[model samples]
Target: MVREFKLPDVGEGLTEAEIVSWLVEPGDTVAEDQPVAEVETDKAVVEVPAPVNGTVKEILAEEGEMVPVGTVIITFDVEGEVPEPEAEAEPEAEPAEPDGKEAADGEPAEPKDVEATSGRVFAAPSARRLARELGVSIEAVDGSGPGGRVTEADVREAAETSAGEEATEEAAADADSGLKSATRKVTDDADEDEPSTDTDGAEAAGAASETVESADRERTLAAPSTRKLAEEKGVDLDAVPTEQTQDGEPFVTDDQVREYAEAQQQAQAADAEAVSGGAEAPAGGPDIEAGGEDERIPYRGIRKTIGKQMERSKYTAPHVTHHDDVDVTRLVETRGRLKEKAEARDTKLTYMPFVVKAIVAALKEYPVLNSQLDEDNEEIVLKGEYNIGVATATDAGLMVPVIKGADRKGMLDIADEMRDLIEKARDRSIAREEMQGGTFSITNFGAIGGEYATPIINYPETAILGLGAIKDRPRVVEREAQGASDGANGEAVSKEVVPRKVMTLSLSIDHRVIDGAEAAQFVNTVKEYLENPELLLLE
Candidate 1:
């Protein structure tokens, strides 16, 4: 039986994806649920997996091609069956090519088939890694698994088979050329559409800094899952060898990747043990190139979404910002005392946990700040539950991961959840639901060295609180003196300046939903709890 595999939704819900790389090609075997290609959506690069076990027969989509949803990208023949295409299998339109541009040497655009997914390589990450560690080329190993998938065992066997093998095909080619080895940059989506190098020195440097256009990527081939796994393990997938290939292109799996990384670490440790030299000089960072005027880069994905949401909020809400200072000396002391206890229970505690507790306490008394505006119905929706959104700045943009029912949780519980959510947001692994259903939001600029900021409301929500860095400043303290010169009865009252910890709080409110006085009172309540953190224990 012949099966046609269409590009399934990779959670973006977008209509199309740019085929980044094909994991398998015609004449190769594949198992059900195995990844066959890597595709780039608007915000992420994801893998397209096979739905059936079969031998690949033909591919409908080309690398660097933008394929629409439900379009058959690849076809396979199962169990000795001849393949046939159905009437609906016809492409609705031609797959869009990356922006047509000339190559570096004044040649026309490079061929789409260059290093294309025109062949098949199937191997686990571990197997590929093992081949690399044993000094074997992944493309040289023959797989034995179904669909010709390479396994760890296959890698071990290949190593044993080539224990004393001669120089590899790659090495032989290098020797035959007898030219100094060199590397060329493989273009990514961010690098594609860039005009070939035409200038020298600084002008050329500016072009490298900003991309003038965008196009498809033709870089290393690996499943999106494998790529993410490699990131989490601090391993470089490109450094791992693979035994599987499509038209001579290597594919990577997870296990071999981790194994290879571990081996490298062990080797580095051994080398360090054998050396008794002084510390090496720190490596210099990448050169910062000056920018060129009139360089315009397309703003899309999360950044575009953020812009739209921000515009809506700013235009729709009547914002009123209130600034105040908080003396959290007691809150700091209490947290420090309990931090060790929290770690013993396998929970990590941060100042945000205490801050959240204080905010929730204040919200219970002033429900208006915890409410949302229902514009269509023109009603104020007072939320009974307290789900607070914590704004975290990531490489992509700002992401708010909400902590659900925060009022019901303890300091430790809130701290742990916040830690996990922040990590997921920064890594772009957070889910849509995790960022929604917030009654109020908080942004801590203090973590990144800011003292205060006027935060814009997260639309529909009533308010947002921005925290500033905590610092020690001189504050007046009252004490009794032995002399009666400035006497209160028989004793003299004296004032002295002492260093005290302080933090600034900037609260932005939707004036339509909350009054200026109400907002001030709510913040005071928060301030009181933090100042007398012992009161928090009673709650």
Candidate 2:
């Protein structure tokens, strides 16, 4: 039986993706669920998996071609049975030549099919044809593709260096430029669009900088990445033009600097050749192989969802962070005492339960902190009830599973509920509903060993609190002491400073919905409860 593999909806009603590369080609056998192609969407690169085990009968799209969702990307001939489309696939192959031949080169000749089905390309088709006529495999030529997809560019580039473009191709292939090469090309274009401020001796000589003017103009401005790129590329920043905007900001653009530096390097290389009569090639030239093999996977599925949410939260919320430290010694002792009782009551007691309890109390006292900013209504929706979300780190990503009505649950109940939610999250068993509708969120990065972090506010919710690691530290205290000499028959009493457990609490709140004073007060309230865990019972 034959099957057609359609691009399933990656996520979020996304409609199309650009075919970056194919992992398999026609005639290659593949297994079900095996990754066959890498597609690039607007946000990320995604691996497209095969739907069924079969031999590829046809490839419907070319690398760098864009296809709509549900489009047939490949056809499979199961059990060595060729699909009927194999006969029809000729038309698909023949039409591409008449279409792209002109754009690739000035002349139209018999175009060799340049299929990168298995991700190997070595030379330009013309070069390949030339090599084939000369009885050579183009593979002998170095590839400049991401994985060294041998390109006309790489062939021409290699040809210029020496007669042995073959050796350079291997060396270049070993150096893998892929994304770095593409980025460099973009950088070159970007450089022309913007000029760098750091000019070299030639640039300085051309511009004729005076002692008085150069000294006065030094502090005013620069291109964004020009100085940095110049330093990396060995181009002096002072020699490049500063007439580029760094994203509308007054700084330099990376392109402007890089272009200037590249030109300077080329000039310096020529000068070196003239002086040393072909001295060990100048310091830096194209290392088109510096970027390791980069598979361009499309941003789809869970990562795509995360990107949207983060962008929304970052743009929509005016976030403010507040920090405070609390001595958790008393709370630690209280938890130790409550553990047995909690277990007897069928509740697994932990420090988080105490923290959750304290948060519930604080929310009740400061209702505004437990509110959401409703953009549609132009008002703040103060949640009369507490639906606390505990951010759980999962393999998919970070998910906040909420336990609604946290105010109603006792510490033990909260602990049990939290355990269930966390377990479900880790197992990827958390339902969509359970992960949504959170009024507020708390992340315990302290478990991950961080003293402070400015957490991004969970969207719509006003605040998020990050807990830091707890550690023992010296604390000062007053104590009464009696001398042994004062009571010969009695014993001497002494007091001294002691080390106690301390924890840091960092709270990030939406300043638009919460004020600095309110955020500070909330932190102080949480600190007070943490310092004295017994007060949790009063709630």
Candidate 2 lDDT tens digits, 171-215? 344333211221222232445544442323333322221211211
Error of 1 at 186 (Å): 42
TM-score attained by model 2: 0.50
lDDT of 1: 0.70
- Residue-by-residue lDDT tens digits, candidate 1, 1-539: 76767788775477656777889977789998898998765544567778888887666555655555776777678855755553334311212226766545353442343222223455544455565565544444576654576554455555544541343444334322321111012212425454442223233223222221222233345544455566666665556655655224565555555555544544343334224222333459476799854433335456767888899999999899999998877778888899899999988988898889889999999999999988899899999999999999988788899999998898888988999999888877677778889999999999877887889999889899999999997888778776534643565778899888899999999999999999999999999998998888866
Highest lDDT scorer: 1
RMSD of each: 17.1, 13.7
For model 2 the local lDDT of residue 66 reads 48
- Lowest lDDT 10-residue stretch of candidate 2: 207-216
